[model samples]
Target: MSAWLPIAPCTPRDCAAHEGARRAPLAAAALLLAGCALTLLGVACVPGVRLLAPSLRDRLVRGWAYAVVRAFGVRLRVTGCQVEPGRPATGELVVANHVSWLDIPLVAAVLPARMVAKSEIRHWPVFGRFAALGGTLFIERDRLRALPGAVHALAGALAAGSRVAVFPQGSTWCGRDGGGSFRPAAFQAAVDAGAAVRPLRIAYRTPERAPAGAAAFVGDDPLAASLWRVVTAAGLTAEIRVLPPIPAGGEPDRRALALAAQSAVASDSANRPAASVHH
Candidate 1:
């Protein structure tokens, strides 16, 4: 899998830290149960949600996403929402730094888009059903042969004015410190459709705002263990900073476009916040 799938050097032992505040076992279990219930509810509502108007559906999805994150007892802080005075809300590619499983709902809360997930997620229990219901595009990242088809699908969606979210890093990293680069192949879709690239940076922190490494879902970490640690981490905050959108049409090629996006996401001084939300 390392041949095609991007690999990160971070392991649970080296990357995860137990520095965050802890919650009682009972509280953690309660929070996890609440989160699970909310997810199931979201899944059940998908068919009804699909019948609603686009604008209304977007709002409902965002609200549901917010609730999911909140139910897990994670405080969300958002900065730099990508909005213009009269820009069309669709036809843009939403890209972000991947940190944990929490990132899916977190981004959806901000900008509800057709998520680009791995094929493995399609076989998971509740999340898989929800993902399929919500129109997630599953990519076989380990297989090089599937690359073109994925890109073509992404381009088709963008051409039809759909906002699609993808993590070009291919796999999850420990944190943003030293992870995989944004692969250029995905950028080709944006270039083909003349879509803009919207980049966002997501980070996990303690109540004191220190880096919450315990939240990292790095190498050799089981999903249940990561999920448990996330629920039990008291006052664990996810700070999402949205960077400026790049016009992919302006770039010479996908490589340059990818580099520009990677640079924007990695930079700390990208700019001031257009708006801030503490949810």
Candidate 2:
């Protein structure tokens, strides 16, 4: 497999563990309904994204992003390095470990940026419209030849002073044991554009801070199933830890920058070995 399609050992059976208190069925249903309503509102908001001034755009995205998670009953607690909410982060690359579908909105809650997403997502139901309206950069991961153009497009966006977000692990990992390796390919865009990289570490935990895997959206885990687990898990808190941004000149190259960002992200956690990917 190409590096863009890095394999993860995480599967729905092994990694998506149920943790934390669960909501009553009726309550869970209510939360799901709320999430759906917010999602519709978000889709409506996306068309205005490119029209609004940068500050208003960021504010709108950030607020709606937080509302999406909150409506689903996930309490978000952000910690560590903070950026001003209204200010635009020019030419910034926001990087985070992939854990669940929820990771997308979680990052947006921090900083609104052009998302580098799988091309398939651009065809997903209402989400496709949302992503397209918000100006997502879709990459054809299965087509290895398409990678260069994707990188060039990402570099171009950054060069235009637009903030961009990417999940460089290329696959989702359960945040326990350890998240999978960060593929260095996306970092090249950062290097080419001379953009700063903001390393964000994300974890879903209980209100008591125990690692919760109910949010893991790994191999073959249906989105509907994951959404059910998330909204039904009562007191689920998402830990959004923002590490210091790595300056554009901090590393000599993208490979080194990727490694440096990975080290910074994993430094606080005792990264135990995750299950290996079988060829």
Candidate 3:
């Protein structure tokens, strides 16, 4: 992989030219088609398709996501995925630090859950619609107003046996510039609902020598170019690690529990072992 890989805005002219020249239109098209197909599949699942069990939707989505990345010529590698034996049973909140847009499908591949995403995602071209159909909850970020609604909605979901995933970084950052940190708000839903919070970490390792901020959509990088670089560049890897589950511990204060869970995730990402491929 090149050293300076761009994320969403800026792209190296050389990389663009190379990708355009050697680009596998079929691969990209396949991804586009598969994305649509998966979205449809989610809808189909709602009407008794029953191919994906009630508790397995998240993993099914993950499988579809892996297929999407593979179709785009990117490899998906997962490590450190294990549910604690004494951990609260399934159907809880899964929280993690937000790294990239890729985290959605990446985590979904491991745990099935309805994502708590920003309301803006509801408007995304293809993804937003698909996420909605996949049981994602888009909420406003305003703390005071959104907190109650978030908690209520999430509690009901968990009580009804739905797994929910939230990014509590308060914003997106890949831990560079010391940019990433888990926000307490992300854990509010789980804490309020007395649900176990499973922390996960997402990292992108590029084989090319792309710049640090290259793969990020921030800065002047074009979305198309950054995406192209990721797809075309060789040795692009997306890794997801599901750390130990944090029991609610009777803590009503979501912030404290959120921090504890965050630390657990950071530790897992830093010290936990790797995951085996599940074909």
Clashes of 1: 0
Off by over 4 Å in 3: 1-52, 55-59, 83-90, 142-144, 208-214, 219-222, 250-252, 268-279
Residue 223 in model 2: lDDT: 85
Error of 2 at 53 (Å): 1.1
Q: Each model's number of backbone clashes? A: 0, 0, 29
Question: Which lDDT tens digits does candidate 3 get at residues 1-279?
Answer: 011111322224422223222346666556555654664565555534244555455445566766655655556766665543222354588877655555666666666567787778799876677667667887766445666676678777876667788776655553443344566655666665667777776666655523223334444446566565555555556666767667766455877887677677666344444655442
Off-target runs (Cα >4 Å) in candidate 1 are 1-4, 82-90, 270-275
By how many angstroms RMSD does model 1 differ from the true structure?
A: 2.1
Candidate 2 has which clashing residue pairs, if any?
none
Task: Give the 10-residue window scoring lowest on summed lDDT in candidate 1.
Answer: 81-90
Measured with C-alpha atoms, the lDDT of residue 100 in candidate 2 is 88
> What would the per-residue lDDT of candidate 2 be over residues 36-97, giving only the tens digit for each residue?
89989889767766798878888888888899989999988777765766644459888988
lDDT of each: 0.83, 0.85, 0.59
Q: Is candidate 2 or candidate 3 better by lDDT?
A: 2
List ranges where model 2 is wrong by over 4 Å: 87-89, 269-279
